[model samples]
Target: MMEATTQAEVTAYWNARAPAFDGVASHVAQGGVWRDVLAAAFGAGGPRDVVDLGSGTGACALIAASLGHRVRGYDGSEGMLAVARAAAEAAGLSVSFDAAVIDQAAIEPASADIVTLRNVLWTLEQPMVALAQAHAALRPGGMVLVSDGLWSVAPQFRSTYDPALAARLPWHGGLTEADARRMLAETGFGDARSWQHLFASPPYPGDVPMFVLSARKA
Candidate 1:
């Protein structure tokens, strides 16, 4: 579990990285194939409400907004939210970006059609709690889309975080698709599915294999 003191350190770590976060290719919103993948995960049925947890720089939130979905993005770092808000404004997209930790966001119960967490689960000290929050925030059949990979495969990626802070995070090394599905299911989700084709080629440097897992609330 993430104690209050550790949580503060985690937020500070992300806040420090916010300034250059979007400089990375995967952190920014690139349309085309990325857009297609997101659209498919969101599923078709008109614009739906989306809640993006740990939505750094609003990449996923902006993309979701561009796809015409109502979106609210939350993160523990105010610096990240600032960046996300600026990006949303510059892109002419309307998205609510607020400061809220993943496991503790005050999302209304059964209020969203979809919940997303991209490359975020691995950083959490309490990922299961975050998943439970996502499940609670969704309508009965809402979907939760989680994206992450074996980031530890690259020493450079692991070196980005403070050693002490990294030691506190449960999945600082990263997580697998099977880990994601099991976590979702344990949190009361069902009909889990995953896609890795979109990222057949690494989106960024390193040989990290990324994946997107979508599961429905039972």
Candidate 2:
């Protein structure tokens, strides 16, 4: 139960964090493995049209592009997009980056072969709206790969969090695997399936399970 954040506030927050966020890759030891996981999740033999919403520093976009998929990344933070652009240019990868609010982010109707949202859903004010937009952007039978986890719901996590601080933070808490499946189904997606893994990142406790929720446009 955190206070609602305005679009401007969200944008500003991420913009200020752009520099540190750009350095995120250094923390991950298995970039190649993660990329392969993503590739397989989206299906192989790609040269597919992919749109990554809330793409941030373009982790998903850059990796997918490397695998020969056409990619377009959208983020609310211009700072993040700037970092993503520089990385793409340095890597000699062709990725189109745009700045747009999460709820307003869009792509051509039935044009995308896949849509990805990684480490992004929990920050959204209206996760369902983003899902609906993803559903609309994808072609019939297109797949969506959503990665998220229950960060704040863990007992160990709760022990460390100050009650007052937790109550005020903008985090949307966690969305469990079952909750993800239900959300996708309700958003006009079908064949919803999910699995969990032990994933860790900076400033967070280890052994927390991250969930990947996959489904296709019906």
Stretches of candidate 2 exceeding 4 Å from the true structure: 1-5, 24-27, 153-171, 195-205
Clashes found in each candidate (C-alpha, N, C closer than 3 A): 0, 0
* Total backbone clashes of candidate 1, pairs 3 or more residues apart or in separate chains: 0
Give one digit per residue, the lDDT tens place, for model 1 in 32-75: 56777888778778899999999988888998999999999999
Error of 1 at 45 (Å): 1.8
TM-score of each predicted structure versus truth: 0.94, 0.84
With candidate 1 superimposed using the best TM-score fit, by how many Å does residue 154's alpha carbon deviate from the native? Answer: 1.0
Which stretch of 10 consecutive residues in model 2 shows the poorest summed lDDT? 195-204
TM-score of 2: 0.84
